[model samples]
Target: MIVSKRIAAVAAAVGLAVTGLAGTAAAAPAASTDLRLIAFNDFHGNLQPPAGSSGRVVLSNGTTVDAGGAAYLATHIAQLRGQVKNSLVLSGGDNIGASPLTSALFHDEPTIDFLNQVGVSASVIGNHELDEGYQELLRMQFGGCHPTDGCQFEKPFRGAKFPFVASNITFDNGLPAALPVTIKFVDNVPVAIIGVTLHDLPSVVTPEAIKGLKFGDEVQALNKTSRLLDLAGIRTQVVLMHQGDSTEGGGPDDCRTLPGPARDIATRASASIDVFLTGHSHQQYNCVVTDPAGNPRPLIQGASFGRLLSVVDLKINKRTGDVDRSATVAHNEVVTRTVTPDPTVQALVDKAVTLSGPIANRQVGTITADLTRTASPAGETPLGDVIADAQLAGTQGNQAVIAMTNPGGIRTDLVYATSPAGEGNGVVTYGEAFAVQPFSNIMQTITLTGAQLKNTLEQQWQASGTKFLQISSSLHYSWSQSATQGNRVSNITVNGTPVDPAGAYRVSVNNFLAAGGDGFAELKNGTNLAGGPVDLDAFTAYLTAHPNLAPPASDRVTVLP
Candidate 1:
């Protein structure tokens, strides 16, 4: 009844109803009304418009203007709730974290406030939640770290209003208690939402972050929780899972289709589950999967960064409150920027903007040249070079001798441009730099033999275009792509000519990659490690000390012609 009326409204505004060609007319309402549910996932702190242009979201009647901010999401949630008393709001996971500096700097406090205002009832735990470890998560759920602490700025972080669920994650022997597993009975519907985090949480997050926790099987977790919910007479069951499948769209920022573990688990889920909402991989889709009983269960995920809103309309038998045997409909709606902002939600957005004003407006410095850190022909970029250089510089007199950076660790491209009016100010903001390298990776200095260094270079063969290894001053190596994997590096040098295989060499790298992360096997076996502080700050200090210098473009770590 709501959708039909909505289409009628669209038709009335666009004159589609005048022609009666706006698709099938809504079937007359059955004895029981329809329940509208909304879900979003992987909103990684992109509160701004993901795209440059704004387009009208053609909602029923006179196209209610809407868009992607948490404010707009709140507006949408409010409007939907107005339509159906039984409406539910939920997330697949990764609602924040891995976001722009505006939110990340505050440990994603603004995000929790926005979610609270948007009426999020439940969510799964995403990998990014571990960015600051479980302690920060507690802060997000409760309040800011301290009113006088650096975590607090213009305003204190408003805590989460809803529950965060993660069923399969277990704490360590002496660690603190984790969040609860499931939620039940929203609006007296006897609804049950079971949460499950990704099994590969350790691989994605820093090992130290998950040091005291263990992530268990998603399917098993859901099954156990479902049985518990069923025994409690809760028939309406949904899974809020954080693990995700990939999309055809390349790059971490793009959202495409959904497949992989999320879909597989949904298709094989216990019959008790009516639907599954997924995240983690940042893909988007509305797929209907059949359970073992051949019953169609809906699998859904909204694209990342609040770019889309997934809506599932289900018909429940009034008496049993069970989804009607043949009445489930699913679709994803893009959150276009044209939607009018709901005043209340806009108020929340304004507060966040005001809170972030000082730091958001500050300019840090400028990239003297185009500092890039993506996979390159020389196996490294200016950005990678900058990061490595900073690490070595930070530990100059400390226990560090050489610093190494992982090729994959570099996330964004850095380009410099003059300020408008042709001013010499080509400054980069702390926010901009963070965007270029979002991961809060800690630096480590390891004592490695030259033989081990050669082996580390050889590991690049395991992943093509992974030869990116930036150094502080002088480190040179050449490899032929055609050579045998282990024998690729031919001319290995540090500071000048060939390096002595038996000589000890101090090298720098982030803790993750040094621990054989991303399958870089040689890094794990390296010797004598030191350091646990954020590498970006070190880089900032280096830049502050030398403001006018630019790293020379060298073909040191090169692919032999």
Candidate 2:
């Protein structure tokens, strides 16, 4: 049997036998085959090494190491695959959407090419996959030029060589949106891989993007798929689910406790499923959760942005056509940059950088200090405040008095350090700004009564979680922590004047929020919908208009204890 040195060491440390199955009563399993699964998630088209904390992975010993980049990831996967004769590369999800300027500028076609070269066998559909809508996702899988932009790269857009699967997402006719399962024969044993996204997908994506889609319960879908695969004699099942949960700070392999949707699903899913690989929360964990039939299976998630890889080693019984649950070993391995990166993938990244350089490197403005999405006690962020102000300014022609933007839309911070582009310190490039707000959601203005505006603020505290809206400087309000959900927000004012519940107010927001994305349904009730410039244009214009932009104060929202 093939086993990497690291996996051997891990098995030894855990008192488990890697070879000959020492723990088992019977040792002679001549019909067994060793299979390795290498997985990563939330890549988000990071062709280049991500900068700052996003590119680092925390190790079991508490030290952080630089990790991730398409080339480096390729090298790591190759090394892992070489350790086993039979192996498959897989993805949990979020492989593309919300990408860096190098990839996003070209509509993330570069990322597809990178994945195609890496030989990803299959991947689940992440919610970000729906950012451009389902039709665009189909294009990503089927190979075609973008409908609006045509072929932007040198080669015609050749879509993903792998399947994009999601068992839970369906169209109006109740047909699956993508392939539900992909079967891989390992040593002649059929292993079924099932993919599903979070059932609460519609809440996160723009309403229009998922207008005709239906998201079913994850556990039910996984169980149903497992049953069907079982009937087809495919007993070895693996899940690539896009939904995940978080832990309070732990190493890549540490699983002191597994709490979240993933745990709940693993606990409820069919025992026929041998392993679970997850993504979307962007947290690293290597856990063993018990299935419905009380069999322990590996449940792992690598930290996002390719910083870590989830490795699962399985011993499938060729005679029984199922995995030996007790023999499975899984861990999260950091994709450190110490190794030699794959030169071919590096060339792809360099080509993309060269193609996108002129537009991406143009100086947009300057930031005196870092404008980040780090929320204060009151849930306001400096970058969020600036984005709201930018949207407000972009719609000033429509007389928008207040502007609000979702916190989730702010992808990254605007750091003041010199980037790889060698731009001067504090000099913000168009590329930097694009990474901060990559969605390109359009700016929209609507008319709402003061009472409706307050209701919109209350919508921030939803059943899912609090999603505080970054407000323009002209709008101010105080929310109480002690009060009930719908009644928590009060002390509303606009431009130093007390808001009159009966007074009509003009508010600005991105098209996503205006359409009630992120659970802010009150925004949908607003009347007189007026469209403005694309949000990215508004932000870059605001940056160019204001040369030395200072980080906005987070004193807009008052939090009462």
Candidate 3:
């Protein structure tokens, strides 16, 4: 199958018309082409079966099953493919980055290798794709030895066997950041697929990573590209979008309360769209929402980290190359452990273990209890608090008195019995600590005025949800619920002294935030910036230095009623 290159013809015509939504379905021509699309999202390079709640699949039938791992995922994908005459494997994105020690230790080559072997045709580029920066993302797609470290795997690195489609992302030169749209031909008919991640990807990743990139509005990109594809004679439009939203529903396939950027985009984008595949929220649901033309269309999302797969069975009208919308169906299938694991993918995972497992398994320290990343209503977590303290202590030499870590930085909970290593319970390993903070971001300390710090905290409440910054124990602040946005935070103090709005404070954060990874853009304005050890190392050192660590009290930030 020939993948699509950038389509320059539509470069000048980026935005599509957003006419008022309709009230009824628009009919398409009869006679169809049966094609199956098996889609998953946010694999996050979990080569091993994800432990704890991250890997369990909850079926609508009320039965739970342990699911995921590259091997099992490969097996289930192959099984799904076997049942269809014309089938293609798909992903919403984030197949790599913020990964486990198994894959991240080697820069996610094992994941790329597994996805290629399992036949991942194409996927949208999730924000994590730019975790290492844009050049690294290109390298992941085009193939090459790492610029800093040469080949680490058995052979020279070849890029993904798939194109990463991102229609909404473009460069300043007016070209798509990635190969925008790809069509998978089924029975000589083109099934148009346009992929785009969140328009706010820069807020979720290091700002520096996306220095030269421009993110087009999601609705505009979809609307424009769908129209262009329609003009080019392709009628079956499938959107592989990484931007996602969650819904309150009866079960896995309900769309009753569908609302978010994804839902908004679905209802406002071009009416030519047939199916919407998405990720980012990492939740699972198969929904049918009224499109711009008022026709109902399937909007699906697979649970994150290889836990589930969304199988979209599309009946494309052979006569007009349009989707038979009424007959389309989608299911969020659990990647159950009952299926026989694919030995080929298993061997690849095993080989990765052999190469990196030794260092990964080394004991770092022990904790008295589980230092979890699970946040409270205030978004404070035991792990995050600990990490914030770590960054503070680690950078004390740089005159840093305060530190804040992003909640997204904490990937997994610090489990007590997660490993098979017999060092007893509550024992922390290098790999386990690595899993908690996997971004490989360097430690950075910068100067922020007391007023700017408050502004940074206020920026958190401005997002969809309040992203409460994990603060060092030395700093304390009170938040008023009834207070307005900029004034919500108050009673700021450092080392028992109320912070003067004009006073300067030395603050530390991972390199991601120092360069404004999240929406806290003020962090970028800090001067006298200095980089220290990588984040994971700083975290590991904290655990090693503080034996018998305990969870911190969730009272640092007082929330007023």
Q: What C-alpha root-mean-square deviation, in Å, does candidate 1 show against the real structure?
A: 9.8
lDDT of 2 by residue, 192-254 (tens): 778989998988898788889999999999888777666566678899999887777789998
Models ranked on lDDT: 2, 3, 1
Off by over 4 Å in 2: 1-29, 59-63, 256-259
Ranking by TM-score: 2, 3, 1
1 against 2, candidate with superior lDDT = 2
Task: Name the lDDT of candidate 3.
Answer: 0.82
Clashes of 2: 1
> Please, what is the whole-model Cα lDDT of each candidate in the order they appear?
0.66, 0.87, 0.82
Q: Estimate each model's TM-score.
A: 0.74, 0.92, 0.91
Model 2 pairs in collision: 143-159
For model 2, where is the 10-residue window of minimal lDDT? 14-23
lDDT of 3 by residue, 188-221 (tens): 5677678888988877877678888999899988
- Those runs of model 3 whose alpha carbons end farther than 4 Å from true positions after fitting are 1-30, 58-65, 246-251, 254-258, 420-423
lDDT of 1 by residue, 447-525 (tens): 8889988888777664222445666656777888687768888788777867899998878788778877756668888
